[model samples]
Target: MLKAERHAYLLQQLSKQGRLSAIDEAERLGISEDTLRRDLRELDMAGALQRVHGGAIPRPPVPASYADRRGDDRTRKVSLARVAASLVRDGQVFFLDGGTTALCIAESLPVNLRATVITNAPPIAAALIDHPGIDVYLAGGAVAKRSAVTVGTEATDFLRRFRADLGFIGVCALAADAGLTIPFAEEASTKRVMIEQARRVVALAGSDKLDIAYPYVVAPTTAITDLVTDHTATEERLAPYRLRGITIHRQR
Candidate 1:
């Protein structure tokens, strides 16, 4: 392919997969690492991609803050939240992870549902505070300023005492190979503990998160019992998870 065509394809790959290592891109494109670096440099110069330590990610028009993320797909999240909330029985225990998607599920919880909620997110706790039937347990630890969630060794230790019926997780990326992952190492560690302590793992993710990989690995994809995502996700894209014995729920 021509350089321009190759560059365009690279951007498409990055958008679909979130990030790509230079060596992998080079191998995929049948080019040398130097050539891939040059391509990444050009894309970076044009503000088409962000060059991270050893990979490139697609550039957003404007930088997204943690608060900004909650508003990006309000309609989709609400629909997914409703489906997620419906999955909760009246008296089950749930662990809500620290992510905007989980926050939506926490807000959409039924007023009379009597589930016990264990969460590290301040927003999730605050959202459920007024619900008379639901009991909220806020895990204590170091607070993550960006997401307003408590996470650390202390929090993980606290969670070990109790097991939840369901663990709702969020992620920066997911791959069949890499599983669920977030950007920060500490957060990933806490999340791993959450997965281990819960009987079933349910991931609330958007289509954008599929097939993506981050620097840190939280759990393997096989760990998830169910995945809830926007309706735009293709059946082909979700087929692998089904093959892995994961139930996939798509929210319109």
Candidate 2:
């Protein structure tokens, strides 16, 4: 496989199993141990993995700044964003949680569709400026410098004033056991409000986010009505979600 493809495979393995066996990954890829080592070294240098003797372990995922996360899963986020946008209809008021993928939804919105977007992310509100049909509302609060999002009590309280038809939330990690989660406590708190206030909630995540867990819990697994992810995810990896009756939409 190509380097990019191998990198995705390696990370996906880390997401699922949390560590790698050099022998197993090498055999799985049908590549020599030397080539696998080189690949692991490259990924380590890129801050994608932590290399160790004989194998690799999941690099302690320190959530990067929004700018960094925005570029990391561009393809998968864009694909998932497209699917999320498809769920919106004109004249609907929706809640958009802050993140790179949520920004993608704003940018992917249809040209002729008219809707109202209420968000804690200034970046996402700014992205909709050119979309003539959409109305944007910005919730006021302390802005998170790294994520360019509103947080704190002001933002959460402001969000409580409006009820939305749909809520498109971005998560740092997702697992059958952990449900939806993020590293930021304030962000997780805001998301819980969004979930309770929205009529239908959709959580958008890249395939790599599956089976991962973060520091704070946003909500339980049953809180979300649907999940949208990239087709890169295997059915085997998605079985748990399906069994839970959470409708899964895989972007092609």
Candidate 3:
């Protein structure tokens, strides 16, 4: 293929899959890896894609921000959120982790429900601000600019002081072997503290996030008591968690 044709092909594939690893793209296109890297660089410079460690992801249609991220996979997130919200009980203290999924759960919370929600997510805190029966405690710490979540030793320390009845953790990725993994180191530490301080940990995951693993391991597979996912998650994919005695809830 001509150079222009190859680049166009790469852009098409990225549009379909949302991302492509350099090695994988090279093999698929029958091009040298160096050539593929050059193509990726050209595309990156053109503002067509964002290059990551070993892959390129599609550039957002507009300038990307945290708000943009929260809008993706809205349907699946809403389903997962509804299932997660159903697990909450009145008069309980709950820990809400910071992520798009957790934000969805906060939005889906019943207005009349009574509970104390502790979180580091400004978005979640804002969503609960007007609830008369629900009290929200925003954890104080250094804010993570990318995720808008408070993190570091201070946040983790505050979490350890209270034992929450339940925790809703949002994960970037999950594998049967790798458990829950996220991209950031400080976020992993904060999530670990939430898991430890809660009596029960409920993970809110979308189907697309399953079977994927990231660099930082937040918690082991055994740490989670339940996982709520969208209806698209198959029984075969959920078998491993079931075998490990974790309840799997699918929302249609």
Candidate 4:
């Protein structure tokens, strides 16, 4: 088949099945595996699909700006925030990532809860400022105005200076095999450090963000100790994360 014909077939299959196995599809198409892989690569670059270890999946939806995301999934984000807040403990050092969901988590924390929160998002830090018992440390770096968060090499280097008891990451895209991913490389750098330096890493993602892939990978799904998602997530959707030994925390 011509390359365009092959690309169309691959895309059609991905849309119907939600995933593709490189080996199996190559055999079906009567083509060498290397040729198939090349096609997948080009498709990925074009933003038509996301290439995983052995196959491909759909590309994730484009994320909204920081301001817009804050209002996108208000109820679901609040529900997820409450559950995530319950996991925090007194005196624990926390790495709170930047994003609308993380801001909600900061707001949901108990007023009297005593803990140290290290964050790169100005909004999250601002939300915690008046919490008498919580100590907030904002990371220093060049701010990415669209996301309203601090990012860059400086932020990642600063995060390496301290280890935290728990790290809460705002996930852009998550898949069982492709792991945690985002579109921006700088933010991915900071999040990778948060995953590495924390004793436990919890990914805060809504159900809509699952089963998709983004351009920049943060860490493998195994790096996450827990996942906090909304109630709409089905057991079928979460089973792969469970198999990876990631404890699931759903909104009640």
- Cα lDDT, all candidates: 0.82, 0.84, 0.83, 0.90
Pick the winner on lDDT between candidates 3 and 4.
4
lDDT for model 4, on a 0 to 1 scale? Answer: 0.90
TM-scores, all candidates, are 0.80, 0.77, 0.75, 0.83
After superposition, candidate 4 runs with Cα above 4 Å error: 1-48
Best TM-score among the predictions, by candidate number = 4
**All candidates in order of TM-score, best leading:** 4, 1, 2, 3
Error of 2 at 104 (Å): 0.9
TM-score winner between 2 and 3, please give it. 2
Q: After superposition, how far is residue 86 of candidate 3 from its true place, in Å?
A: 0.5
Poorest 10 consecutive residues by lDDT, candidate 1: 57-66
| Count of residue pairs whose backbone atoms collide, per candidate | 0, 0, 0, 0
The digit string of per-residue lDDT tens for model 1 on 183-209 reads 777787678878998998999888877
Model 3, 132-164: lDDT tens digits are 889999888999878889999888888788889
Question: What's the lDDT for candidate 3?
Answer: 0.83
| Superposition error at 14 for model 1 (Å) | 7.0
Task: Predict model 2's lDDT versus the native.
Answer: 0.84
Q: Model 1 segments beyond 4 Å from truth?
A: 1-63
Off by over 4 Å in 3: 1-65
Candidate 2 positional error at 120, Å: 0.3
